[model samples]
Target chain A: MSEQFEMVPGNSLITKTPEEGRQLAVKMARLVIKATQPDSAIREKLRPIYSEDAAMLISVGQVVATEFATIAAANNYWR
Target chain B: MSEQFEMVPGNSLITKTPEEGRQLAVKMARLVIKATQPDSAIREKLRPIYSEDAAMLISVGQVVATEFATIAAANNYWR
Candidate 1:
């Protein structure tokens, strides 16, 4: 599955059209969600800390998405 | 300043002690916040779309943080 997924080049989304920007955001969101699945082995390891650090998790996630969106707009990827 | 900050290797935080995991999360949070500063040039480009995409941004941020925390626990970086 990893082989099937091509790595997105750094900041490439910044150059896409507005429509493309939204699409890219959606794609990224999906990927993040998949990586953080509750039952995943990674999640199990992280769970105890996460239970106490929910606020931090949310803040970090917001930053990541914000950066992507910013890259999109800076490059005029969005209309 | 960029030269002073070494790029953290992928998943290095995962192997850190529990205390180290918390430190890493805090560090990552700070970095992300700096990158997404509201008045930064990048933010200016991203603002309009973000105004409409606030939910997405929040969601994405949560995911990134969650993944980091997961990595921390998976590697026994956190107790």
Candidate 2:
């Protein structure tokens, strides 16, 4: 609950201490997952718009998944 | 001229109309250029920390440069 966790413009949540950054990255991962899920309505809308970069889109999805897993391991959030 | 140009997280300036997005992208490009210039102190500080992803860093630099050029063309800012 540091103010640094607050997503503000020109403020990078990833530049904090590793632990804090991991926590914030987890939150962002959750948002990205929800937004990009294949069956999700938003994803359906975004698919055509971002069709040219499908690989990059998938890579970002994987990055979010991996980051969330790392956060879960560190915080024991899923244990 | 619009509030959307503000660089705030949870508020993507790139989602605006192409013209507005281009303008905001130029501003971001300027910041990135300043931050990543070779022989610059900040780039020296970042180089060691981001050694593993040197290509990605360079790609971001190119993206900013290209976006700035696009903005300049559309707005006739350079002409």
Candidate 3:
């Protein structure tokens, strides 16, 4: 069967645990990258520049951390 | 000039206000959609189906709500 690229809508994030939220946070970050830059070849070319930049790497982590914090809140701080 | 699709690395989300966070939350949700589909024509075609389904629309809102809540938390619930 052909792979489906459609968005399968769900609200599991509202009830997900922190661990799951963390995973999703990272995934969302990667999704943004892929979405913003659909060209894989260019992404591959730019990878080295980012890998070599300490600040860039840290910024990426920060984005993921931000996502994590937001997800944690959506899950009601897992309280 | 060519439009750049590069992700400008930043940690602004960590310091943004609730209003800004809300906007970003919605944006992130859209980014996921664009990233996952990577085809404008397909997205446009799928839009009508999602728009007609109440549950689908609610799920979409829930995703945005989850994002909003997460962003609010990241902003310390705007405290």
Candidate 4:
């Protein structure tokens, strides 16, 4: 899956409750996965080609792939 | 450069003024880069191995790689 997203972390969201942050995380991941699909037709492409690690990033976005789980765990999610 | 970051998109930042969003973008990019550096010792590692696409992702993150710049361009940045 080739996923391209614009994630801008802000103080407001970061300060939110863990539950709120978790919800936001799940939503963002879904959008990213959908956007990356060939049929998504988002009309906006990030890179001409998806790299070898694109899959890892896409899964991480969706909250299912744990390649980057430690990053989330340290922040108090996916414990 | 290997970078691990926790970026959560939300309505709060998305609804903010472009200026604010841009500032946040730059800051987030910097933090991700710093966190990924081996010497940074952030103590949190996302993927045990950086993929072939890791470089692209890292550069995309620091706002210098631009592999995913089009995503930003369409959203009203890097235009």
Candidate 5:
């Protein structure tokens, strides 16, 4: 799996505002998913299974929280 | 659990750009997580368990994809 986050021409995870911080957190979380599992078809197929499962869905939150933490750090917790 | 995604001031998932579409998709995913599991302590506790588990992480991707699809529709698939 690719360890590096993709850098689009104008897209970035480094945010300038708290709102941007939230957006970047989501973007980074998706990047990790893409890096870990590049297959969109597989992800789509698994969606029905995971989306309805509360445990699986909460697990998704856990991953997003982790990404948000990293973004929070980068923004010095948005200080 | 709350069914509504919180509407913070100056924050919205209704986006104007493809990049914003991506950002909103992620934010929506996170909102689902927040709604599914409202407790921060429990989510934090489960973080380590999900973060190291590939299946769990991919599940996160699945959820994000679902949200992205919704955002795509709202943006007319960024036409």
Candidate 6:
């Protein structure tokens, strides 16, 4: 696999900080949003990563989860 | 980064089959559910991968997306 561990959509790696995690999640969410849109072109581009309905559900869930983490960090929940 | 492309939770790689992708998404959702529980021990184990609230949001979203994908494949939407 010609790949390196660069943070992309749906990755399970933990970020160094809460902010980093949130940002990564947001990026992933964008992929879902695009793939779900009513257009084949978008799907074609993202199909490699999100080639099924299950991927869409996971994408939506992940974005929400990451947002939760980001807000917690912002509100000093971790403190 | 000491990693290989294998199927796991919250992963964005497109699986060869829809079933495989859904299974992966479900695995990630479980991670979020566990991390959100009122226990630090579980979080400690998953911290390296889901280390923040943002990650949790993403986790939840991703699981749903995969489910959707799986269902679609089952219904022959891709056909």
Judged by TM-score, which candidate is best? 5
Candidate 5 residue runs with Cα over 4 Å from true position: A1-79, B2-12
lDDT of 3 at A61: 46
Better of 4 and 5 by lDDT: 5
Q: Where's the lowest-lDDT run of ten residues in candidate 6 chain A? A: A1-10
Candidate 3, residues A2-67: lDDT per residue as tens digits?
223322125346634544565566567766776677777988898656544333433454565567
lDDT of each: 0.45, 0.40, 0.55, 0.37, 0.60, 0.44
Off by over 4 Å in 3: A1-79, B1-11, B14-17
Two-chain complex of model 4, DockQ on C-alpha atoms against the true structure: 0.06
Tell me how many clashing residue pairs each candidate has: 11, 1, 1, 0, 0, 40
lDDT of 6 by residue, A1-79 (tens): 1122222333332355667656655664544333223244633554454434575556555555754453344334435
lDDT of 4 at B37: 63
Best candidate (score: lDDT): 5
> What is each model's TM-score for chain A?
0.41, 0.35, 0.73, 0.36, 0.73, 0.36
Tens-digit per-residue lDDT, B1-79, candidate 3: 0112211113233444777777776665555454344456755766676678786666666666765666566567767
What shift in Å separates residue B42 of candidate 6 from its native position after superposition?
42
Provide TM-scores for the models: 0.31, 0.26, 0.45, 0.25, 0.48, 0.27
Say which prediction, candidate 4 or candidate 6, comes out ahead on DockQ.
6
Looking at every candidate separately, what fraction of the true A–B Cα contacts under 8 Å does it contain?
A: 0.09, 0.00, 0.05, 0.00, 0.11, 0.11
Candidate 6: RMSD to truth: 17.7
Model 1, B1-79: lDDT tens digits are 3333434535366643433443354356545545446346775575445323334334544545455445444553222
Model 4 agreement with the true structure over A1-79: per-residue lDDT tens digits: 2323443233222323556556544443333333223343321242334334576456344342221232233244533
Interface DockQ of each model: 0.06, 0.02, 0.04, 0.06, 0.07, 0.07
Candidate 3 vs 5: which has more DockQ = 5
Q: Report the interface RMSD that candidate 6 achieves against the true structure, in angstroms.
A: 14.7
Please name the candidate that would achieve the greatest DockQ relative to the true structure. Answer: 6
Q: Poorest 10 consecutive residues of model 2 chain B by lDDT? A: B1-10
